[model samples]
Target: MNLESLVNLAGEAAVLATGGLLIGMAFGGFAQVSKFCLRSAVIEFSKGLLGSKVAVWLLTFSAAVVSTQAVIGFGSLDVTGARQLAARGSLSGSLIGGVMFGAGMILARGCASRLLVLSATGNLRALLSGLVLTIVAQASLRGALSPAREMLSELWTVQGGPSRNLLSLVDGVPQFGLWLGVAWLACALWLARRARIGYLIEASAVGVGLAVGAGWLFTYSVSQVSFAPVQVKSISFTGPSADTLMGLINSPSLTLGFDTGLVPGVFAGSLLAALITREWKVQGFHDGPSMWRYLIGAALMGFGGMLAGGCAVGAGVTGGAIFALTAWMALAAMWIGAVITHLVVDGAVAGSVLAEPLVDQSSGR
Candidate 1:
């Protein structure tokens, strides 16, 4: 490329990176402030306490679905363009990987996104889990386990293009999905208000949804106008963690994109929050057994994320927002996996389902 072309490329990449960073930071801050974790949601739900956390989770998703559909309706994006929402959706990957991801999150005491935030807050145990999760996820994506990944994906994958989303199934009537989301959001809001949910919880949940929606909008905008080959995507920690690591180690040959910017941005945002809150402190494992458990948890999460084609955030939240079939499948499978782990491993998983409003993280990990 010529000098002008190189400069233009750099400028475009910068813009895209900036958007990704802002999105990541928003999510990081929201998650940190809210102590948001799918594992926590499952645990609390299992305990029969349909608390504010669950309200936050459902509202966040409903908001995302509504916002995402708005973007698509405005002709700014297409759900089918998303790799995860592509024509060929893998059922096996969703089922097996989701199950593993759920169990792993419980074992590690947090999901992939939760660990990332915790790691930034100087939790050495989370740091270790994050590292192992990254390595194992990378292996599953492109390393030793890639063959198995391919085999499973191919074996159970089905034609999902035509029915990838509600809009597509309804032949471009995105209003249907939008209305559906609105109805869900209305119910969520009613429940949240009835429970007297706190402002922080509601704001954080909505903000996270906006962040996810903004990611799709920004990436779509960049891909639409940028001359360079840019991949359109939203947030997902598993692949992005690997992509970021590769970009860091091989900057001369590697081109940093949305993923590279996002992963570090999340860490930076969480780090900033930790610093401001005076929560940064070393927290390594207390014993070898605990360390081994974390290691195993990381491996399961990594393999499962790759097999499922995305982690909790990737599939459950991002893909689910767009109404992807695989995402819903994975979300259910992951939930089942968590329930099983809680029943068998966590011993009865019994607790009262309190009707508390979603509020602060007074009782969180």
Candidate 2:
């Protein structure tokens, strides 16, 4: 059927969006407050100062696992919608793209999600990065190099892999899948304990991560029911940034689409918490040189993510957490990309603790 026939289920989309918004706000707020930054986490780990960033990382990761699965168990796991684990999502693209994305993150001093929260927190560099990221993402989606990306996907596609949604495997034989997920949960908990995050930070990390996972499950379970059975999926920033425009301009073109859309949720969620905490702060730009640096870093990140197919949060948290091989490829690629960016820009691959508000070292996975 056509697009209009699908989105006609306005209420379902609204629920999905609402769930996503809540997740976004909580994630943003947690990120803003606890500094849940992948860039900082990695940088610090690389630099040998892995004290602070560890707690939040494990917390967020655990939350993603538990909450996402809960949504799945109820048959709400929208394997089709999230756009992350889809068959069309290429392995080579995820690997190369992630490395590039990660390297850019290392250079730009944060991951895509971190960039968003950092921009909100008055980091002019991050603000510029966000702007550049948006533009480059737009171009990559349907711009000059899109044909290249498409061709690349056609060329290096991996065989024998489950060429459908990544989450499908987990849903198929849930007994084994649940065990794996349990192992994941155990590992996250173990990491938290080992990190000595105490109670508050660990709790916060789990809270934020699980909330996001629930958003995924909500979309998969809630939105897919209609005149026709549609596949559900999770969230990712890249395509959605491209898709956000599609939603507005092409609303008439869609009968139904994935409902969870996490990026929008994070933005809205973060803002709500920020406002509630009286953090309705509006950040501004710095001087020209700083702007240039931010733009350059963001451009690299955009291209990297374009190649990788998702940002750190997309691959690292959402996909990687779900145990998608492609997601891990992207995450590794992202880290590598960030490191490459750092090598080219600052001439140092790793360094000391954070000197600026948004410039902490990288955290652990």
Candidate 3:
């Protein structure tokens, strides 16, 4: 539908919400089928095993980078005003928070987006952990934990604009971002081929990337058409999840926007996919220790995501696709943290007969 038609039909808020819902559904479904999880990829890589998990993650990341850069190269999108690049960002927060988030995901057995997806697939452990994550996220964003987040964010700040944009650093290179994406895509393809990944899985991984690109395009389009100011944003779960949860709890009337619609849309889409594939089965924590581990992980993710300004998918993929400096830093920090945590935590209990499984059964490992 044209922009004018959409605005006239349900107003700006509705239009944004609708766009988020559609994009979120695509991401959720593709992610479910592809078994895309950053934690898994990190684990596989840390163990020196370049397996299907790593291939799927590489494909998804490369796809997002390629598609988003392709649009920018074609002059269809301008992300200069996006929060990741436009606003003052924190280097300290990105590093510290990224590490925390990585370690947290290792313990939780999922990232923010993965928890939401698993919750939809009848995983009670995920559902509970997701709830804790949301509540803690809300607390971190505006409640008691906000001060700590703010303090970390202020430790080292970079002014927005060209400084935050990676492409801007390499001035005069025509479509440098696009070429970078292409290189990554080539690597992803090579890895996928070596893993002998099926076409359907590969396509689904690409779909996840396309969904991220669509989010950028859709929001930008809405901003152009709407009379009011609209933030041009793509997929990210941290702030959105907190906003959604708070809207449900405190607001008399929920604010209608991209974030308000994203969480639920992802949940619904994942649920649909699970049911269709007969993957929907109730699963819960197998023991008290496992339950504590999940809750602790959820808490860490919530606070860390808020402090870092994004979660695994939020900062790592969505922001990284745009070549935001802090996003890349955060992504690197996450890898370091995940690898270290796996080696220390998982390795500590590796030889124990009573140690919990390395991969959660419900994660489709």
Candidate 4:
């Protein structure tokens, strides 16, 4: 709050931001190259297609779990100490929020991270969606809509012992983490081996996992050194986006944090990749209908993400890494929501939304 305190906070934020920048760039480049969209993966799986992207996502999740837990086992990180991972979690919030976010991604035609990448690549539609997402998410977190989120979270919250992770529940059974990680890795390997772009997919999957796992380590390390109140978190777009936008007009106290750096880092990293790969293009709304759809969809995602405690990357990957029940349940709910949206909006019956051309354009080795 004072001048000296402000200077220290700024220095700490700068150091944390540097780490975030490196992680974001690595993730962005890989995401662009592999076209790793969570929405696309859900759609593809629902459509009965065993896609490589899904495999890559699973591999990343497994790797993150393995690496992060190893750190916890070695006393390097304390995820359970984080408020979000407290013993009590909101089941209803996760379900409702996941459903909303999943359906919204379908309507918006992309997830939060996808929009971030698209925005960096000069997509006007994504830019608008990003802005809406930031504003709405902020509202849900601390503004007018926060009451609704709190009510839902309180109504259905449940307690799960001293710690919510699988290891703790099972009394720190070492083999559980080992087997879970192995099973996931095995499935990912099988998927990668069967894909047309096997080698590329495998490499990208490993890179994404390393990036995510390393991000947790970096942030945790910074938290240790700062003596300031910095939360231990990894790659999550919803809160970070809102924090970045709000931090602009507010005091440094509001803006100086890990999420603040991460949101912009993702965009900057994606922009760098787009330029390097010559994929940057200025795209805009095709008409009024598209604009309206994006606005509604972004708002939905914003609300859902805040209520559920994270977006696709947040709950899906980061939360999943720690074997959190909330993450898995939310992910399942999101997938179901996406399926229903595809059926009603796309007018598809008992099939996936991923047609061949859509796959070609969105995903290619």
Best by TM-score: 3
Error of 2 at 253 (Å): 13
RMSD of 4: 4.4
List, residue by residue over 176-246, the lDDT tens digit for candidate 4: 77568778888878887887656765776666676777778877777776767677778888988888888
Q: What TM-score does model 4 achieve against the real structure?
A: 0.88
**Candidate closer to the true structure by TM-score (higher is better), 1 or 4:** 1
Off by over 4 Å in 1: 1-10, 172-174, 194-197, 250-254, 348-365
The local distance difference test score of each candidate is 0.77, 0.61, 0.88, 0.76
Task: Assess every candidate by TM-score.
Answer: 0.89, 0.78, 0.97, 0.88
What does candidate 2's lDDT look like per residue over 1-365, in tens digits? Answer: 43244446455555456556666667776666556777666655566554557547755765686667655666646454445554556777877677767666765567778776665554556656776786787777788867876766565665333553455555557645445556766776776677776776676667667666755665555544544454454556666655665566657643233433456556665555555666555554433444555565677677667777677777777776556667777777666665555555555323222212232422210
Question: What's the lDDT for candidate 3?
Answer: 0.88
Please give the RMSD to the true structure for each candidate, in Å.
4.9, 5.5, 1.6, 4.4
In order, how many clashes per candidate? 4, 54, 0, 1
Candidate 3 per-residue lDDT over residues 1-365, each given as its tens digit:
77888897889999999888988999999989888899999989998998888989989998999899999889999999999999999999999999998988887888999999999998988889888988998898889999999999999999999999999878899889888888988888888989998998899988998899899988998888889999999999988998888888888888999987788889988888888999998887777766777888899899988888899999999999999999999999989988987887788776443235665643643
Please tell me which predicted candidate would have the highest lDDT against the true structure: 3
